[model samples]
Target chain A: MLNVTEMLEEIKNSPYREIEICAPHTGRVNFAAIQQGSKVEGPHGLWKEKPGTLLCTLDRERNPKPIAAVEKGELCLLHSELEGCFVEAGTRLAVIRHLLTRDEVQAAILKKALHLFTAPERAKYYFVPEIDKKVRTSGSQSVTVKDGMELFIMSRMKREVPLVYTGPAGLIYAVYFTHTSNVDAEQPLIGVCPPDQLAAIQEVIMRVQTEWTEQG
Target chain B: MGKSNKESNVAPAGGLIDVSSHKVLVANRGEIAMRIMRACVKLGVAFTAIFTKEDTASGHVRLAKELGGEKNLYRVSSYHDANELMAVADDAECTAVHPGYGFFAEDFRFARRVSKRDRKLIFIGPSWKIIRELGDKINTKRLARSLNVPTVPGSDRPIYDEMEAERIARTVFDFQVQQGIKRPLVLVKASAGGGGMGIEEVYDIDNFRSVYRRIRNYAMRQFKDEGVLIEQRITDFNHLEVQIVSDRSGKNPVHFGTRNCSIQSTGLQKRLEVAPGFSPDEINYSFDARKVLDDIVHYSLTMARKVGYDNVGTWEWIVTHDGSPFLMEVNTRIQVENGVSARIASVKGEGGVDLLAEQIRIGLGEPLGYNQQDIAFNGVGIEYRLIAEDPDNRFTPWAGLIERFGWQEKPWLTMHTHVPTDVPYEIPTEFDPNLALAIVWGENIEQAKDRGRLFLDSLELKGCKKTGGELKSNVAFLRQKTAGILQF
Candidate 1:
């Protein structure tokens, strides 16, 4: 059994340039590493040297890169907070930059998931605009609509912005845009529109990015 | 853009090669085709029946042969071109053609082609020019505006995008507010289509985009044109229409009073109709709206005379709570549920159907003896559209043979859309959603409704349960909705 905070602290100090987390069959969240440049060693020494890594952008054509290799099986953690959660035991939680020392690489991974169990949450869902097309795509395709295409709220409210989704291709993008509200603590609040109108009806999703600001 | 390449071709005028000898051909199908065929029989003219492939076994086609000589029957393709239908008339060695409603009824191009290329076939019903004029929604709206006939408020042009949709919605919302109309709703509708097709309602802004997209797809699919218009959604309204007939001879036009078709499906799909909308005072029902009918006839006649809509057509209107009548769209051909009007037109003589005889006479330039002053009613008439679908399943359309058919027939329960047995029948998907309807007339509205319920309950269709329960359920729902039973 591993301590959640200590593991997160070790991973934060590690040297991964990009990080992604997923609760399989549920959802995936990703973030780019902020480390400018770092190098790390591998178990196989001089004969097989790994390249140093930086927070460089991947080509537009590629999907996000993965860092951890979580086995496709259930996991159990002793911590009360991670009771129902699954994290691979002894998993190499971080992939370091070729330039960083093993110690630094481990530290970066720890910092990233410092509040792993208590972190605020957000959700995104993809829905098929029409039944036939979605079936054809098989939920693994991507459609490219030009940016600023006008997303609408379930109510008549609309804003011109493209909805980007790394989910099912034929489905329109809908997300339970979760955020911390002043009114509630423990539970994250989300904004969502009506279901029937979630499909290719409107282009951009009118998300409340800054509720504290008054535009009018 | 290129002047449409469409022109109304006029027939070569003369006493139809030989009025007594020339055969009349009806290049159509269904009850309307039968209606026209009956008119031909009265003229003492040898008749020809041209049927589509699907209608070869139709009761109408079969009945046509039983009434007319066997030599008059001819078969054509169901999906064949309209010109092919006209050619069927020519092949049958016929002198005239009557395009029954549905296929080529409002097809001005086909009408012109029949009158021009064929030269001999007299095009019955509206002149091709009138069909061209009123067949278009935008042009008709313009004409209505010019005639001071009130129509639903909305943009006069096709709404192409969301901004325009929102703009129109905002304007209409504002107008509704200014007019003191509470909780006003709006509708996005396709201009070219009719019969409740390609119309969607938007209750609030959030749903507008979704509704607009659906409506756009439907409009494009149905009319093959994505020209959609937005209008204020009218609620708690009564659908009323006056049947008007005009002829080229043009002495005084006839108004067959008003029929109330208030009971309707919420959307632009098939609607169930009830006639002689319930009124406590028969003489003074919808008085202001009745005056509006007079104005509507005047306007419709002006437009009809200009375009030349002879034969049967309806000047449709709707009455709101303020006791004001607003002009709805005009139906160029006889309405499908117009069996009520058919019965009203029918005069029981010692020998034959009186109205049927009179309609034929009017076609050939003769007087219809019954005047406005002579018009009187025996009872109330109610007509219900029997859609071939399962009601519990959102009315998904059903197509198959009607194996068994029986209805509660009372003295006043005159069932039209006569699917005569003694022959096989195949109901097709090409036309209306409604396969058939049972029209019942009574001493009053309640009696008519009771007879309607009886006819609906008694209707036994075996091939598929034609939702007699759903129809009865819907009628009950409507009665409650209109507060017909609950009204003080």
Candidate 2:
């Protein structure tokens, strides 16, 4: 892996990204109560069943569906001009400048540090039924995989065939693909950390934990 | 290619009432929404349509836009939200709401709200009272039994006492024995539980106690209600339906014809449907097929008349291997396969019978100008539900952006779909990925089957998953089942 210090330094220079929240459907938007630079929190709870902060309500066909902030951030930009006016779906409503959390920063660094097993083709990939069920119940990190293992079942064109793992395998450090959506060709399916690399990965995470300061 | 949505046509006047002033809100999506809009336009009535964010590019949205009316289109959060529909109706100044199957179609509460709300709009169906009366399974079963109409051979009410439950189970078994049935199975299901939960099938009466206790215990734990329903589990039967159409008067109910929907998926969901339920003229059967069809239709009409069913509805039934027809349930709204029956039915020798248009006319308080003697049937019609699914994988739904969908136009073929051909469409995962419905008509069963196969063969559907593989459809499965259409 590349030097973790340089990666951490680069991230330190810019530790935030502005994410735009758009109307999920066509509706008259009401952002009267929202103000710029206000703080927001994403869905949080043991199960994440508790919703995030309400940013605005998009009223259409008599139903007003509230758009919630999905990421913890400061409301840096709000489209106040479009308030009370009918807006089409995907219309820019607000933007949040979300600061990098400790987990996020570590995840960013680990993405480059981990040996990513990418999808060979654009198709729905699943960890062959047993592994899938295990991965669902327990986190993907609990499952260990080996090289040349029959891991995934790549479903395509109504046909299912076993997909053999080729790369040096280990504990799945991170699951990069969801079962519901399609994973693009060459997109990483899972980030694997071999037994030898586990210590190095831990050290990098520890170093970031100590040096990085989280912002409110 | 089919007629574009932008194509303007003059609406023809039908029935005795001039319902031109009414504006209908099509509170649904997909092909059903498209059909409702077409019906409204056909009757010269203004209609409004709604689409969710996922349905931005759907044909229904395009049709509503091109249909040309003030505030005719609106995007809602969900199709299930009744408030949104009512609000849209009020905003659009619509006088009626047509719940085009699914969503709020069969919901009596939604229908009641539509009628009872301050700014009331006609719930373009049977009145809420009638919907509530027929919507309840227990009420329907009891009513059918009271009328001497054949319902399932089982308890109309839930059995609470174990002795009573066992006694009913014994009667069911003895009844099957009296009917000379072999290997009769008794179904023990939690009255409070549905969707196949807490349900057990007992092949032998000796072991029913163990199964009953397990079900009762499971029900008490799961639903907190130990009540159970005992019914004779029917096997080797054909699922049939009678298309009933009546006016607001709730009287003079007449049937279009019988439709056989026995062909289904592994989950027992209907896949292929045929009008004129059976062909006694062509196929030989152990029982009188013609008499069975007539009996079911007559029973359906009798029930429809009893309830004052004031709109288009379907009476679902199952004909056993020995030809005993039992009423399953009553669908209080127009069905997805309504067109199949309409394809073969003619009112007063008029070949084209648009049932939705008739429904709207009747819903607006206009009586059905014709009676049972006027309605006639002439050909075999088949309806194929085209969907993006893997038949080999337990009908697993496939979600992907549909890139291309096309089919050749035939003289006897009518295809209904909300999927636009000119542009790619992302399949909305929130709802069932139903692509289209192809209704093919033929002079006879042999011809109908041939046409169905030809239609499926000529149909071209191409799509790819977001990640990169080709989309899977049930076309091959539908094609294979074409030969077995209406075969008992």
Q: Which stretches of candidate 1 lie over 4 Å from their true place?
A: A1-216, B1-22, B69-71, B118-120, B159-166, B268-309, B345-376, B418-426, B429-433, B465-488
Runs in model 2 with CA error above 4 Å? A23-29, A33-74, A86-91, A110-198, B1-18, B69-71, B154-231, B466-471
lDDT of 2 by residue, B1-488 (tens): 01112211212233244577789999999899998898888778888888887688889888888884536888776787676677667767889999988778877899999888888899998898888888776799989999999888788777789899899999999999998888989989887664335677899999999989877866775567898989999999999999999878776898989999998876567889999899999899889999999899889999998888899999999898989999988888999999999999887787888888888877876667778888889989999999898899878778788999999999999999999988899887556678999999999999999989999999889999866678999999999988887777
**Distance (Å) between predicted and true CA of B150, model 2?**
1.2
The CAPRI quality class of candidate 2 comes to incorrect
List clash counts for every candidate, in order.
39, 0
DockQ of each: 0.01, 0.17
Worst 10 residues of 2 chain B by lDDT: B1-10
User: How much of the true contact map at the interface does candidate 2 reproduce, as a fraction?
Assistant: 0.20
lDDT against true structure, model 2:
0.84
